[model samples]
Every structure is written in C-alpha cells, then in structure tokens.
Target chain A: MDFAEICEEKFDINRYLGLLCHPGCGGTSVFMGTSRCTSKISDKTVKALDYTAYVPMAVKKLKDVCVNARRTCAVGNIVVAHRVGYVPVGEPGLFVGVSAPHRQAAIQCMDLTITAIKAGVPVWKEEVYEDDTRAWTTNAECFWLPKPPTHSTDLPQK
Target chain B: MDFAEICEEKFDINRYLGLLCHPGCGGTSVFMGTSRCTSKISDKTVKALDYTAYVPMAVKKLKDVCVNARRTCAVGNIVVAHRVGYVPVGEPGLFVGVSAPHRQAAIQCMDLTITAIKAGVPVWKEEVYEDDTRAWTTNAECFWLPKPPTHSTDLPQK
Candidate 1:
C-alpha cells in the first residue's frame, strides 16, 4: 500500500516510518524538504516559509510518482507527504518515504520518486526572509538555483 | 556539525532529525536500512538480524564519510547511525541523514554517503531466518547480492 497527500500538520517521523515499514522490506529511503534560515538568493536570511499547492493536481501527481516507482521497481510501500501553510526554519515542509525488499530497489525508486516530485509536483513555496524580502519558487527551480553565497557574518556559523 | 557512530540501541527518528536539523539547511535526505523478514537467499525467510562491527575501525570510517561529504558538498549537518545487536524485522538497522543549504547538496551528499557506507564500511550482518537457516554477510555484499525470485507464496503481499 502507499500514501500520498498534502497536509497542514507538522510531520511525525515515527508515524511516517510506521506507514512505510513492511516486514518483507530491507531498506527504506526518505527525503525531506526543510525550510532554511538562509537562502540561495544571497544577502537574504530566511525566517520561515509558506507553502501552497493546487491540491487536486498535487495529490494526483504525488500518487503518480508512487505508481510509477512501483511499475519500474520492486517497491514495497511508500508514504509521500507535502505540508501546506507556514513552515518555520528547521522544520520540514515535505517528506517522501519508500521501502523495498532489497537495498537497490529502495534506493533507486526513492531517487526516481524524489526527482519526479521536484520536476513536476504542483507544490510551490514562498521564502519569508529575515529582512522581509520574499521570493516564490517552484519545486523544480529550487534545486537548480545557484548556491547561496557565503559571507563571514552569516549567523549560526556552521 | 556532523555525527557518525554505531549503537546497540534502537533508533529514535526524532533524535536523529534533531541532530541533522540546522537553520541554514533547506533540504534533508534520509535513508534507513530496515531489517527484513525476507532475504535474497531463496527458500529462506528472515526472522531478524544480528549486526556486529569492529568498533574502532567502523567508527573511524563512518567519521571519514562525513568528512569526505563535507569536503565535497555544502552540507549543513549529518547524522549517520548503524545499530548493532539484534534487530527484528521492520526495525531499522541503519540510518543516514544529511542536510544542506540547497536541495542538490543534500541529495548528492546523501547519495554519496550511503554508497560509501555500503562499499567499504566495516559493519557486518548475519541474517537469522525463520526456517532455522542463517547466513553472514558484509555490508558490500548485501546490495550486490542476487535478488530472490518471487513466488506466489510470498507472505504479507503488498
């Protein structure tokens, strides 16, 4: 069985693990999208993030990801969740969990599923910066964006 | 900061997430190696698994993985844990969590770190099967091992 949906509640890791676990599976892979206090836009310090989604389409694509992974790999179970509304820095806004009876299947399917999510999922994010500067991003653009330039004065060093 | 260590206690997912969470991080990738009731060895079914390690060397290599990841990627924090001792089916035996300022770094570093662990880490496992059959293996051998062909009687059908 698999689960894919968008919710506004804070994620419970253990709960997701419970949903993903299968006695026949040997490996589980998880990817989380967490809000950052720093942004790749340079000179910006993020305080939180706001997430929105076209619920019907987003949910449909998320399920399609699971279905596609299963069609191509020996996936056991999956749980894909994307949170809507406010997400503070250091908090997760998205989670993908998958399992397979073998390591390669779990790893391969997970990588494939996450890539699919980033490429086509309808989820969008608006970075709420410390300086009140804000920017919106699609799931795809965030990964390909330039790295945030580092400075000597960036707070909470390392 | 980064963490890598072997433990005998069951993993608490929240604790690991706490260790990996950093305000500067926008993405976190997690991979869990769960104990399976099924094994690649045909005609056998796993009941649990027993793990062991050469602590000094294992810990050293684990730390090296983190250092290597940091050297190559803009990783914010990492937490790698491999549990020793008995692990029942559906329980996690290993976890690798990483976060970065951007999604690519987190994803790339996570993929790299896991591959490194499977390729050379000193951890070992002995599969305890339900039919009284047992087999020992190294971390490297597990992933490359031949997949067990599926049969109609596979229990707990997905």
Candidate 2:
C-alpha cells in the first residue's frame, strides 16, 4: 500500500495496522520514523517539526519499494505512509509495513522496503525548535550499511 | 509487545505495525512463513497440518531472538508468533516483525531473528495429505543460502 496525504491529525497506529494485515500472510514487519527533539548542529531541543514530500515522486518511490520487495521475497501485503505538515515530538514521521508467508522473508522484505524508501524517496523535513527556530533538512545521508557477520560458523545451513 | 493467549482468531496486523513504529528508526524489516499445499517429498497437494510446540521453550526462543535483535541492531521492536494445533492449506504459519533506526539494521536483525527461530524453536509440524497420509517436517532445510554477488566489483550488500 502507498499513501501520500497531508495529515495534521494525530498519527493513527490502527490505520497503519489495518493496511498491513493480510489473512494469507503469516508474518508482518514494520518501521516507524519519529522526530528527534534534539538537533545535531545547534543541539537545540526541538519542540515540533514539519515534513513535506515531493508527493508524486515520493509515492512512486514507495510503490517501487513495495513492488521490489514482493518480487524479491515471499511477502504478501505492504503499506507505507508518511506524515506531512507539522508534527510534534515523539510523533511518527513515516511508517512502513510488510507481510509475508514466513517470518524470515517478512523481516528481509521489511528491511529492503524501508531502505528503498530512504535511499530513493524525496521527502524533506524541517526542525521547529522550541525557540521558534526552524531549518530544512535533506535526507541525503540516510543510508543503511549491513552489519558484519558475527561468526563464520553461523553461516547458513542449507 | 509481549502476548500470551490462545484463541480462534485471525491474524492481527496492528501488533505487527506496532513492532515497526519506532521514532528513531528509518526502516523496518519483517518475514512471514506460510503453509504450502504442496509437499517437497511427493509433490502431492497437502490438505491440512497439525503443529505442536514445547510452549515454554518456544516462548523462550522467541524472546531470545527479540533480545538479541535489540542488542545487535538499533531496532525498536521485534515480534515472533507461531500457530499451534491445526492449520489448513494456504494458511499463515508464523509471524516475525522487526523495527530499527536504519533499513540495514532492521533487515539484519530480522534475518537473524527468523534464522534463530528455525534453529532453536521447538515447534514441529505434521503434514496431512488427502489420502490420510501424514509425515513430520522440520524447517532445517528452509535455511537460505546467500546469493552470489552479481558483479565482480560489487561487495556483499547483506
């Protein structure tokens, strides 16, 4: 599922949940992105924030991730939603859900889905500080690097 | 979130969504395992199956995956659930959810979570065929092999 809407309303976990469920699926994975109260540059505590997306492109990217995941993994249903406009601290900025037939596939698909969103989607956010300061931030560095294997003996036993 | 109960209920998508909703996270990964109607042995269509688990041990293993995921990755929540008793063809067999601050971490944790479940959980399944034939199956062979790198210059991504 791909949704692009300007929501100033409260983040609805139930709505996110509803979109992620599929009877045919046995596993579901999700990710939620929230605003941090502290800024890395000024170290100012943030009170609120505003998020915006290049709606058409963002939606296309979201759809692309879902489609790619479905093709790559044994996944069933998927949902991705991002909150636009003003959001308060502790509020979710983005949400992604993936459902599949097996737990492992679901987890793997979810990882790929979220990664695709971050690397490809054109979404931007502005931090609104408690002192009425605000600045736009780009998601250019939101890349994920895979972890090194912990043990050589932990290799896949196929 | 932790749950302990038994009911004749359909799958719950919200719980899975909850697993993904972590504010510090940029990605969420998941895996789902389903019941296939075809058997690997005879390639015959399956009818139903009975699942049994050493409840306490299974729960312990599930919790262990969650704990390990949190420690190893910047994940928000991890969820794993398996069905017991009988399940029909095309039905859901298990659920696993993981949420992390980054897509790579989420994917890594989810992969490990599912792998641990298969290796350590005491859950078992007995397949029932249309001809009243029955046989037990283990998930040992379901372990996946990492795909070879697509390009000579490409380093391993997952």
Candidate 3:
C-alpha cells in the first residue's frame, strides 16, 4: 500500500524505498533532502534544522500531492514522509519514492511531487547555526518570493 | 570520498547513502534501477535479470562517467555501482548517489549520470521469464535502436 505521514523522529529511507517495491513495477525513483552543515545563503556552519507544521493541514496536503502525482503520471506505488522537530546536519528531512512500469514515469513522478511539496506543503524550517544564531528559512525552491503565498487559494488546479 | 565499482553480489543502498552524508552538503540525491517483475514490452512476469559486461572496460567507463559528473557539476561525493550476473525482481541492479550543496546540483548530477550510463555503458542484460522463456534485453532508455552504438569512441568530450 502507499504510505505518507509526518514523523517526529528520524525517518528511514530503506523502509520507504522498500514500500515502493512491487511485482508490477519495473522501476523506482527516489529523492532525499538532508540537513547540511553549510548554509547556502551565508555559507555558515549549520548544526541542525528545526521543522514545524500546522499538523492537520500539512498531513492532508502531503497526501494530496502524492495522489495528484499518481493521477497525472503512470506510476504505481508511492511512499513519502517528512520529519518535524530538529533534524541534525547530514540527516534527511524528506524522503520520496515512486514506482512505475518504466523509469521515465518514476523519475517524472518524483520531480513533480517534489515541486508540489515545495509549493504547497505548510512545513516551516529554521536553520540553527553553529555561531549561536538561527534563521527561519524558506525552501530554496521558492526562496526568492518571501514566505510562499498561502496554499489555501494557491493550490494547483485539480 | 567517491566510489564506483561493479558488483557480483548485492550492493547496499544504505552503505551508498551513508557514503554521501557529509557535513558540508545540504542535499543528496539517489536513483536505483531495480529488476522489475513486469516487462514493458509484453507485460510478462519476470523472474530475474542476467547481466554481463566486459569487466575491465565496464568498470573503467563507469568510473569515467562519475569523474566527469563531479568535474562538471557542483556535487561533492558520489557512490555508484552496477550489478552483474542475475538480479531478482524487486532488487536493485544499479545505484547512483550524489551529494551537493543544494538539491538542484544533486538531482541534476543524477540525471546526467544516468543518461550517460544508459547511452554509453556496455552492460548487457537477459530477462528470465517465469514461463521458462528468456530474451536478451536492452535498456529502455535507448531501445529504439537495434542495439546502442559501441561506446569505444563515444566518451563525452572532457
């Protein structure tokens, strides 16, 4: 079965990847975003990343993104999870896995799903620096546009 | 450190992913091509995929692809390995992982690397069907051609 959830503890890529394996699928594509030690903006040393979300809305939105991807693409199974709270440097904050009858669909499913999440998810992130400072940051995918426009009305057309 | 090798035994995704976790990198992208039970051509159930390669040349070419990617992209560490011999359905036959300062670099690196492998690598595969039939197969990426042209002189310009 497909899986999606918000985890407070660290997430597992192996478990997620395992969920995408099916007898009908010929290819699976996966992407992971981890907390890095260096800040892209300032190049400062990073210690951890703090993530939070409006739980109910975030959960619903996350599932919607996956469902939409399945409908638009020729994919079979999908498993995606996001972590909340503090994610240490070098630790993954997001995991997305997709399975399809062929490689192209699988890869395209991941690409579309990731873009959707960045544009729609309600998750918030704060970068904790080693210099005893912290900054709330937007996902790099849409960082230039202040806080992303609220998704309630900004949702992709069905 | 970067890694590139050909494996007759099952290679570890966890091991390869672990190799990509570095303090300086904010993102790591990974792609795995597994032996699927279904064939896109006839929709037949697959039992296993038997792969063969000129070990010396295949190994050298694989490393060259990775080296070329590292030189061209903003990615940091990379760990890639291809399987030879038989790979059962639902098991990965190829794995590519790359770490970079941001997600874009990591993702693009994987895309470029996969394209290069499918277009240039000399691995051959035979599909074993559950009904006791077998057919030598070419990777789907370039299946329109009878067989991919020899890459002996097809290496990308350095």
Candidate lDDT (C-alpha), each: 0.81, 0.63, 0.80
Query: For model 1, how does the per-residue alpha-carbon lDDT over B1-158 read when each residue is reduced to its tens digit?
Result: 88988988999788899999998887898888888876665568788888877888888989998998889999889899998899989999889999888777887888888888876677777787776556774344445434332332433457
Stretches of model 2 off by over 4 angstroms after superposition: A1-29, A36-42, A46-49, A64-78, A88-91, A98-109, A130-132, A141-158, B1-28, B36-49, B87-93, B128-134, B141-158
Off by over 4 Å in 1: A138-158, B138-158
The number of the candidate with the highest TM-score is 3
Clash-forming residue pairs, model 3: none
List, in order, the clash count of every candidate structure: 0, 24, 0
Better model by TM-score: candidate 1 vs candidate 2:
1
- Cα error, candidate 2, residue B58 (Å): 2.3
lDDT of 2 by residue, A22-141 (tens): 654555666666665656545667776687666777777777777777788876677877777898765677777676656667666766776677777767677777777676654555
Instruction: Looking at model 2, give its docking quality level.
Output: incorrect
**Comparison by lDDT, 2 against 3, better one:** 3
Q: Predictions ranked by DockQ, top down? A: 1, 3, 2
Error of 3 at A5 (Å): 1.1
B1-158 per-residue lDDT for model 2 (tens digits): 43322213444756655545555444455455656566654555677767877677778767876776677677666777777887776555666666655557766776787777777666777776777667776465444423222332212346
Clashing pairs in 1: none
DockQ per candidate: 0.68, 0.20, 0.60
